[model samples]
Target: MADITDAEHHIVAASYHLMKALQTTKLMSSDVRGILEKLDFHLSTVVKINEDEPDGDSIRELEKSVVSSHETITSLHLSYSKVWASGPEVILEYLEAVGEVQRSIEALEGMPLSRMSNGVLEQAKTTLHMAMERLQNELIHILVQNKQCFEHEYPVFEVYPIYEESVISNEDDSVEDASLKGRSSSETEDCAMDLIHPDVVPQIKSIADTMFAAGYAQEFCLPFTAFWKDVLAEYSMILYVEQLSIEDVKRMEWKHLNSRIRKWRVAMTRIIGVYLGSAKRLFDQVLGEYDQVSIACLIEASRGPLFCLLNFGQAVLIGPHEPEWLFCLLDMYEVLADLVPDLDTLFSQETESLIRIDFHELLSQLGESVRVILKELGNRIATCTSTTPFQNGGIHPLTKYVANYILCFAEYEDTLPLLLQDQEPVRESGDEEQNMDGEADPNPACALAMYLQSLTSILEAALDEKSSLYRDSSLKHIFLMNNFHYTVEKIKNSKISPYFGDDWIRKHYVKLRQHAMYYQRTTWSSLLTFLHDDGKVGKATLKARCQHFNTAFEDLYKSQTRWVVPDPQLREDVRILASKTVIQPYRNFVRKISDSIGEKHIKYTEQELGVYIMDLLEGSSKSLSHSRKR
Candidate 1:
């Protein structure tokens, strides 16, 4: 039994040792597998890294290409640093060399800098930088050399007819013809002169493209913009655009200022519409691929001169408001308004939006200034008064001035409405009554019309006030008649007639007639009372009436001879009306008193009275005095 137990223990110990051996072998195999898997992963990663890197031979070839391009660029830059002065063939070679260098630099940038020796990479960059610098200088030189000069002493602006005669056959002619004919000569077409010489534009574009591709756009623009700005300044000088400050404009005398303002209008139109337009075309041609850069350069180059032009307008805006400035201000407003679309198109780039905003702000300011000046003109007309009566009871100077002034406004009818669009129409005292039955016309032209009507009404009111200056009621009526008649005739004959309308003309005509009637009643109605036969039953009373009538008629003739009527038709009408009022009655008085008071008692006969009345209102006091002597 002891021997069997020893055998079982030995078997158990052997089994335990076998299990420990198996466990140790399994652990060793697992460690070896993990190490092999890690090695495989590292191998794959190394392969991928190697795949991404250029081969040694490829790197050497790229290096050779870079070295060759660098040598070529260096040679070209040294040879053609003043490429603008070189021939086309040399320029082409230089541009080709620059292009080759640009491609090499791009390739070098794509590869790892570690692959290229630091020296090679630095040399390539330096060569490209120097080449771009030369190219920039060349571009500026080309632009300056190729700039076209104004050939004419005065800038000649051509105006083409808006409507083609082919479009307007006699059969198709209608009210449209009138409107088309009414277009101002100022509504002109653009005649863009070449700002840059046509021969060198492609060369400039090539240099610009190369510099832009080389990441030297800023360097390219710097010199290009600087040179062109001076060119534009010279062009402005040629256009007679003086860079006057606001204070300088303010200090100028009006006569000199007026001439300058005229020149300014012509210069601004030429600069913005023609010269700037040509510049824009040049930029579009040269930098067509880089629109933003082109626009930025244009704005930078032109902003100074453009602002100088606007400064003149600003000076005019803040200057003293004078009635005479209206036409020039209107001209400025029209030109600015017309250029808005051009400005919107030229400065459409996001980088150039500020310039567009400035132009629009100036336009708004100009429009506002125009409105204020118009209001000032109306105020001037309204407040222009004289304490003393105008001599001779003839048409007052204010009447003639206001009449002719408003007549001039009709020529600007198309432009005035645009400037006055936001303004409320000025109304006279009775305009409300006149327009109460009808809705106001919303047409823009009507706005100007309403304002013009108000001016006429103000003129009439001023004349009414001036009439009171005459001490004699008859003379007062005569003065009102003369002024109103003159005003009516002026309106009736001018383009201003359409603004006031037929009703306005008729209303004023009736007012003038009322004044004429009033004059007759005041001057002659009292004399008519002397002709009435009250039964006094005495030759003495009859002779007394005859004598009174004779003396009063002669006195009326003498006093009225100096009162002048400027219109021939109006003078004839007044004389005929005066004859109808007084001639017949005096004839009856003379016939009745002829038997009682003979020719001796009667100082004048009907025929003689007729001759004197025919001479009324002729403005010839000497002729009437000579007739009285005869």
Candidate 2:
């Protein structure tokens, strides 16, 4: 074996200098020169090891030097002042490692005398094998440490980039030509609604400069790239697309706030970009990628503003206080629905996707997160655990917007199609962009409106005028229990999502917001009944509260038409309620109760609190019977 000191010398020296390089941000000529000199030292040693027989000594030296070079390169990469600063340098280091082995092989076996020997072949094979292994380890380190670089899928949502005629031909043109021609008109319109401006380049560079100058990047390269790559500038493209879409809105000069609608669509694009990443690629087919031309078209259309066409539609269709916004929102929903199925498939099936959390475990986590955040937000809004409906800012802003949009858009369900095709024409794609504005382009029905109506049915039950469960404490609890079942079923369904996604969908948002109305309504009703001081109300109301709690279980069990099997405890608890109390006089009273006017404001809250209780209780008889048979 090689002397331990030699290996330590290589490793310790590299580590120490890397620490120094990472600590210093002022890459004065001297600093740059010093790091360059250290880089040369590691490169020289690695190259020398590759040329040698790679006995234990040489192998150790190679490993140590490679480790140090990797460290230094990684540190420098973290502090990249511009795009060129990091990615290019990393590629260079990779090239250097590869080149060292190639150079060593060439040097040792160039001549005829050297090439013909079996001894040389054997030694060369061993050396190359060792070198490749080291290289593999290095590559693995880079990928694991910097997986965030590839984390976002926004960039990959476009069509394929390149293809051959024998493979992905699009009828008339060669694959290359066809791909080059790029995205469909409506597709480009979607893309344009998402592009970022080149103008932000200078500002991004400036921030990089400050970080590089401050040693922030060197100290934390992974986080540095993450902050810039994932957070700060990632949505720049979306903003650019928004601006471009506005330009289209200006060109069209349509009536009734078409420009404003464009703005909202642009905002929507940013929201998607925040979750999905900037890389756009085509769906993987059995043969090869089919997104080539479409991918480019997506990027180009997104080059202006995101969803400009939606904005145009909105401007044309919706007027303030008019019923048309519902229709326009439905159109947007249709487009969005077209985009969701593939995304759902990707999360459910793709190995590297972020949506790979276990649902039950995730739901558990969401429960805890929502409690903490909603309470905190509740505090901010001057509310509490016992506060009644219409509190806590009336749904978090994003949720409010999405839900209200869905609710309003429900009216246009008839106008939308049951199924939507993914491809849509953009106004840009050269002459075709203008041509799409013409009446000749097929104006298809939206898919969003239909989905929204189904969603509306669930909420409508909470808000309906004649519903007995809307205000009755017992009714409210049971309805919320049913709602929880409904929501869980939605989570399991093929369409729509309970969350936006892994990185962005805080566990708190789902539990706190989705269940907020139910939680508020039920909790307030339960508490008020416990503490109500009306003189004549006495035991009658209190006993009814208890029976209502039990009947709430029955209501929840009935709601299980949506579930494959209602959670078992729900039935057991209902059975327990049957044994403990006889509600001879109250059954008719329970039947007579009507809907609460305040239900709409507190729907999610009541549902939240009720679901929690159901989780704690036993299931109805049907659920127990089914379970026992199973």
Candidate 3:
């Protein structure tokens, strides 16, 4: 026991030390076990040395001697984690150190350790291989077992599409090649995540259809949600393929798509006996169901195939999107168009014409009913927020928008009516015989947009708390700031207004924006002063001051994007405006500022302010964008 200084002495003696530790209530060295009162500094050093080494016989022998050392270590880690969690830098460093040791074990095992110089070395190598293999298997098992956990968490994305990477719009071949210049492995790994590959839609569809025919039960809704996990897992190898980029999803084979569309098209023409499939007697119930279904349809319409329908229905109807579902939506409109006559048919002529009544009012009443649902949604957000936001994580923004709307505004039952309609094809007065086109009733999307802006403005004005959200705040601080704005926005926009003007929501948005900007500029100056000078806060704290404002701006981007009723893309243009105007240049500013943070770069305020303006315009920051395109 001559001072376990040599590597072999520390490793070999660890086994006996563990054996001694297991026999006593308190851990003790083998020789000192009989003397009940002394500290075992030698034993602690041995264990520390063991934890750092590649997995080997010495560590396992020590672990086996100690009945519950693994559990004890976990407990110790947990007890101290709050302190480590507070400092992300330390936590990351700790994980990295642990990971490096594990990586070394893996590399050692891969070599011809079977032919190591000594019997102990060969045994240690074999033991390490077994441990690594077991760990990998355990990870796979856990992921498979918890497949439904992800679904339950991200239900909003059940029908929408998810892109693994941001779509790279860069078409320059020179930049594409040169972009790999002077980049580190970590940067390359990050870039690898952005590549999107074409989906095997035809194969998935064929397999699903065959499986269903072979009596396989459908466990989930939507093709993507059901198959996405395994699909993503299997294709994960694509992430490791250097220089090979998986591109965006390409169009499905027209041969397969057209056959299916043609089948549905014929069925629809024959099945379309009435206006809304079969909503003759219970028009009210049918309308309600339609509202739910359309909302679901809109969820689909926001991504993948549905995105094409909403965005490019006229151009690629026969091939990618097809005209049938579009026709179905159109026919659903006809059913509503028939509502006026159907009411007359059911009752006497004196009954209030469901036709002459304002469509907006009917839709507004429906929207009001849906608003009551938001309370439950808010509670859920409060509960599972770390894992899932108000809208689930990885879910499409529009999907979350729909879920949050339903959750928060449960009372405002019918929002879809404000979005869709069916009316008589009225042409030039005398020649109203063939072509069917009518004037826009009120443009509910316009109204929804207005309400979102107004609501966001209200939050900005009330909270006039931060100058920039991302810089000065932790995610927790940013979340608090964002949540405050969220509550105000949901309250204002999700519910309908009593004021009966056509553009009431629009007016609300305008007023809210004006008041918000004024209040933010006026109040934030004082807040900056309060946070900066009085408390002697660090640069990080000062940087956090900007987080609230960044959050507000994100909410603003979401509001403006989702506000447009019939034309959601019109709102999407605002994102383009936000990017071109604020983000790109400020991002460059952040790179410079971030470099000089600890060593007194440019002023923290300038960087904080710049980052705030930039982050707001770019993120999926608000609760969820509803009333607009995804």
Candidate 4:
């Protein structure tokens, strides 16, 4: 019995030394296992001693049970120490060690010892729970370090040039071979990926997965929300197309913009897939601020392109060049409609309404801009009603701009009808127009056609107002002729023929011809009547008539020389008509007057008279007076 007591004392002594060793030095996993084995043996020895002394004093048994409880607590402390040494990478093994500690506490509680072991069991459970919390915090610390990756501002928006293989000078050069030709060297420069790189989404997703696996999924939410919000804010600033001035837009190149938009759409789609897709929807369980942040990101992705178009439209309205932005906006819209589906699918109804509302607003603003410019031009035209000659011939100075605007409208001939479709009345059944794929469009109403028609009216009214600016009746007719001819030529040369229709153009052309005929018939008819009826007058009166004819011709020639006829064909026709009007009558007058006066009272001969008439119609009055020797 004494030897048995000594063995128990030695067991207690060895466990004490083991606990001291664990407290002093950092022990390896194997060393911890060995220490735990030694502690386990001591605990069993106490329990065995308590069992063997069942007939002894109850106080001795209680003492043995107390010694066994202390050894069990020491084993738990040793396991937790290993947790700190191994760190978060070994978190799974650490959890298993914690489970082992829990089972040991239960075993100790179930033992037939004194009720005081209950206090030790409870204390063990409390300590293990606190240790687990510490380990979780360590895991969170590791993830927080990873979160620093998103601290810097990345370029979320950028433009790059899209290059295609150049046309080879030699027909024999293959596409691949031609691609090898360089500006100054023989090496080719192939198109590379975007400088921002496309792997950003994958990198973020990989980190998120790793964090979830480390049991820090919930803890990751705060940092992720903060980081992503920063990303969105940064992206918003970089791609803020609305902040651009007219000069900035003037510097924009469409191909580069198109290329950047394409790549950006791709990136946006990928981010949506990562954050909202079914497989790893990291934001599904996140509520409150995180959820709002996630939704904000989606909204920005869907609305960013439209905002770009809006800003571009505004810039176009402010600048002299308006057509290019509209053209590029339409192209980008078409490309996105075909390429991107997630934006439509995610916010189907909202996207439709937003697109239509935004587009209509853009059209309304553009129409107003067109109206203002045309109105200003009309005011200028009203003020130009004077005898002064215009700088650009008979045509209005604004004709070039108006023609270009009309042609711009014509470029969207196919698109206009679709955008201007009549809005069907809302039914209780809620039926709507379906696209080719049989999906009903959410917003089907557009007034772009009416807006375009209004712009056309403004343009037409401005042109008509300009035509009335000429004071001379003949010059007014010439102004109308030149303007109508210009309109007809622009329509014929461009796709704008559709807007005016064939009949409208044909009718305007007829009006133009009638104006030309009126100027020819009425302009010189009274002048030609004087040279007629030479038989009714005496020789002296006929000589006076010849002198009056010379003075009238010079006055007419000097004034009409400054009156411009821009079109070559029309100018020739006017000259020919003028010749027909006066040439025959004047030649007859010269003959009759020469015969009647017999070159005695006549101030000019028939040959010199013929040359004067030629000069009058040919618009070269400088040499008319010098033709006396002829």
Error of 3 at 481 (Å): 11
Model 3 earns a TM-score of 0.20
How many clashes show up per model? 0, 79, 44, 0
Query: Looking at candidate 3, what is the lDDT of residue 529?
Result: 37
Residue pairs clashing, model 4: none
Worst 10 residues of 1 by lDDT: 173-182
> What's the true lDDT of residue 364 in model 4?
61
RMSD of 4: 13.8
TM-score leaderboard ranking = 1, 4, 2, 3
lDDT of 4 by residue, 1-630 (tens): 133477766766676566656656555575565565455544434433433332334434433443344444344445565333444445445445545545555566566564334434444455445544554454344334443222123334332211222112111112221111011111111112221223333433433443344344544454555444454445444533234556775676755554444443333333332222321232322322333444444454335444554565556556552332343444333333432354344444454556545655655655444434433433443333333444323665445444544555554455544544443322325433467888655442223333433444455565566556556667667767776787678767775565455766677778878988888765676667668663777766776776676666666667666566767777777777777777777767767767666665455554554444444323333534543421
TM-score of each: 0.78, 0.24, 0.20, 0.50
Q: What is the lDDT of residue 372 in candidate 4?
A: 47
Model 1, position 2, has a per-residue lDDT of 16
Q: Write the per-residue lDDT of candidate 1 for residues 1-630, one digit (tens) a residue.
A: 012244554564565455444555554654454343333322222222222344544554555665566556555555554876778887777777777767766765666655333434455576678778777767777777777886436634343211111111212212221111122334366677888889888888888888888898888778887887888888888878878888898898866776677667777777777777888888888876785788888888888878888878888888866665666677677778888877777776653376677677778887777788789877877777676787778877677666766766776788887667578766655564334558665668778787887788787888888788889898898888888888788788987788788998898889989988998899889889888865555888887887677677767777788788878888888889999998898888777767775667776667888888887776656333334321
What TM-score number comes out for model 2? 0.24
Q: Which portions of model 3 show Cα errors greater than 4 Å?
A: 1-400, 403-503, 510-630
After superposition on all C-alphas, the RMSD of every candidate to the true structure, in Å, is 19.2, 28.9, 36.7, 13.8
Name the top lDDT candidate.
1
TM-score of candidate 4 versus the correct structure, residues matched by position: 0.50
